[model samples]
Target: MRPLDPDDPRSVETAGRAYRVLARIGSGGMGVVYLGRSAGGRAVAIKMVHPEFAADPEFRDRFAREAGLARTVGGGFTAAVIDADPEAEIPWLVTEYLPSVSVRDAVHSSGPLAADAVWDLAAGIAEALVSIHGEGVVHRDLNPANVLLTADGPRVIDFGIARAIEASSVSRPGARAGAAGFMSPEQAAGDAVGTAGDVFSFGSTLVFAATGREPFGEGPWHVRMRRVQSEAPDLDGVEGDLRALIESCMERDPERRPTAAELAERLTGRAGASAEGAGAAGEGGMASLPPAVTAEIARRRTAAENPPVPRPRLEPPAPLAPLPSSPQPWPAGPGRYAPHSTMDPAQARRPRTPLIAAAAFVALLITIGIPGGLWFTVRDTGGGVEAAPSAGPTPTASAAPASPSPTGIRGELTFTIEGSGRVSSLTYMFNGKTTKLTKVRLPWEKTLQIPSWPPRIPWKLSYTCPPGGSSDSVAVDGNVIIRGQGSSGTNMRSEGVL
Candidate 1:
């Protein structure tokens, strides 16, 4: 059926008395959206099935079944289904009137949303999908056009084409109930799809929200459909956490994609993060976006209004009482509170006597400098070197033969040389102590330096490589010294500065 212009009066009277048609809001393949009022004076968007579909009993039944399932999946993230008439001459469904622009309008008019807003949008849509999917229904037509941006949050709409998990494939011939650039690859291929298909669509919606570009690229509807299956999204321009997320969603393999709940959690992690790129282009010189686009939206809205109803007024209340004075102040934000007991005393006023005593006790032992605090100081000693507690540190010098060097370092720094490498004999001395390493590798073991010596004493290691080896050196300061043959014809040298 041809789209009836909203300017035409006949379109307003097409639906039955179930709703009082006000003005046409929009139109699509399944239905025309009209701003209407219920018998109780509640505003709603009455979606009447197109005349072509209304004439077919099979299509009408499927539309009604899908809408009914959508209503059962109640959630704040979705527009609430108010009423519907499956037996009417023109089947129509009414949903709570959402006085906000669809995501398509927001992007086309105000440009793409900021990173924070984009994440929030993704979260809201994902939450709605979670609810829809929980009811065993798949919103097979998720797209930017079906998402509305309101003051409260983004809302998912138009479940006229949703499919129940157990629903049969008895849809009408021309009823391809999804946006061209937003459909998943599986959906485009006419294969049985599951929740992952919705995830793919959600990813495409994010691509639109992030860069004002469709994930599957753009062209004629058919050409765009072909791209969804045959091409990948060019994510070079999109930034922030969304880049990886969109990549995961748009991956050719559906099994690897995250579920709606998983996507919601991921997006929640990214909310309020800083945005980059052309997404922040708002109105006004200081606005985060361009003004021309917002103005166009406002103008379109004004033209669409029937008689321009007055904005609602909310009255301010009386002044609030003054807060009480107290020594204790309120905790700020989440997980913040004052200590209230010995387990967690206020750090400022807590006594440190115990800590001081503990420190003094340990320091006194160190100062005495004996293997034990005092040898035979106890009054009940048997006269000789009565065995002190086993915990006492035994003087190893007395226990073993006294050698010139008490302790020596011994550890192999095995370097795994990559790409035709070898290690030659290396020798270095530091503070009169000699060390040697042999048969290292190219690009790894050209020089060795022991850095534990006294100040200003430089030690060197001589190793050989196949003529051309690494000859680069960087000064690094540390207590334990090390130097080695380095990369690609450069002197491998590093100084440890303690």
Candidate 2:
């Protein structure tokens, strides 16, 4: 068994019942997910919300309502909710554990799925959505991360952002819900959404599985949002029946898009058939996945059954015999150590050699106007004095100006927002131009590389949250700084020099 992380909770309880947390498996903007075991020995995935959000009444209410809806969903293509405590000091929900990799990871590691495999994936996800929507819950965030590819099929998980059909807002005002590339146009626009939104997201996910790229081309969050809203998806490499089905689901008009039930029927060749017939047809879909997928699933199961043994680490070789202590005298020079023969044995034994060397080093630094606290080696090159390079603070005048390298910014720009209020947008002004970041989630911290530009460029950052709450703006002066304030009047700041 793998050792537990230091930060993993030893145990957690709800309603006075305890669960031994084994390890952390995942984390997101809202909470951390832990692998845990109940007293009954059943394993579960426990999602614990950040403590800061637990105090927000709105968040608690939403959490409770969603967890209740999630309990109503039942199917082979989805993980079942086991327990939840939305009122707990740290709100948490537990679901049956499914040991599987996400479709995202699968595609990243093994490339895009074959046409048959993509069809199987679509059918499984559509069935999951049918069950989820049948329970009157809309999974607002149905992206790749929320879909788990198991031996049985792809099991839809993570209904944390789900809400009832009648609920007006999935998130606070001005804050859009769902992931950027997977969101439907309506979702990106912050408009009322329903089961259709999930269909659009499902279509996008299929495109990703088939082509290993988001339907919308990559860029900043806002750019992806624009493409989702206005531009046709770049389905260049996708073709055949799979292409037609994905295109139907991705129709711009929500009314024109196929429902999850309809999608399952069409993909399984049971279109215009009765519900029972469609169910029977869909049952055979998983058996049709590409041989590669089946092989991968079997390989994974076998590996799980028998974990690899860790190899023992070889001990490092013993340090070479201490070089024979040679009685070498310091080279004679004006600013160098004198010959040992010139010093008495008593003086050398007095431990004054370091003191004398230090004094001479200090004098040399003063003479050369070198910065203090810097270590330098002075050498006589037979004719002139030479100094070894010093690993210290750069000199003000001679130092090269820090700038974004050809590859990109030398470092990353991080934004961390705390408290109950959500961030609606983040704007960065650089070189007389402004880029607005609208895809950020509330109570989220993200680090992204800045676009390449000249060194010492002046920049500014501004963000918007709930109105009437005090928020701060920070100026970017070629140095890293974390600046933001919470809705509850909590101040936050951090700095890192590149």
Highest lDDT: give the candidate number. 2
lDDT on C-alpha atoms for all candidate structures: 0.56, 0.62
For candidate 1, write residues 1-498 as lDDT tens digits.
Answer: 111232222322324555566665655434457676666676777777555556666666777788778779776678888777777777778788766667776788778777667776777777788888888888787888788765456678875454421132222222244666788898766577788988898888888887888876754444565688898875767875678888888878889998888877776644432211112223101122245544544554454444233222323233223212222333543787844422334754667564455445434333343442332111122211122223454333232222222132221112112225444554444445567777655344222342221212333334444344433221111001121234444433322111
Q: List model 2 lDDT by residue over 1-498, tens digit each.
A: 222333346677877777777755545445567677788887777888655456567778878888888898987778899888887877888888766777876787778876666767787788888899898888888888788776566788876444421132322334554556888999877688888999999999988988999999764455566689998888888897778888898999999999988887776642212222223313433434445556676664454344333223333233222211223465666678765436458755675564456457544553443343344455544322444445665333122222213344433454445334455666655546666777455545444554433322334455655443533322121111222344542333222221
- For candidate 1, the TM-score is 0.52
Off by over 4 Å in 1: 1-17, 160-175, 272-498
Deviation in Å, model 2, residue 407 alpha carbon: 24
lDDT at 328, model 2: 49
lDDT of 1: 0.56
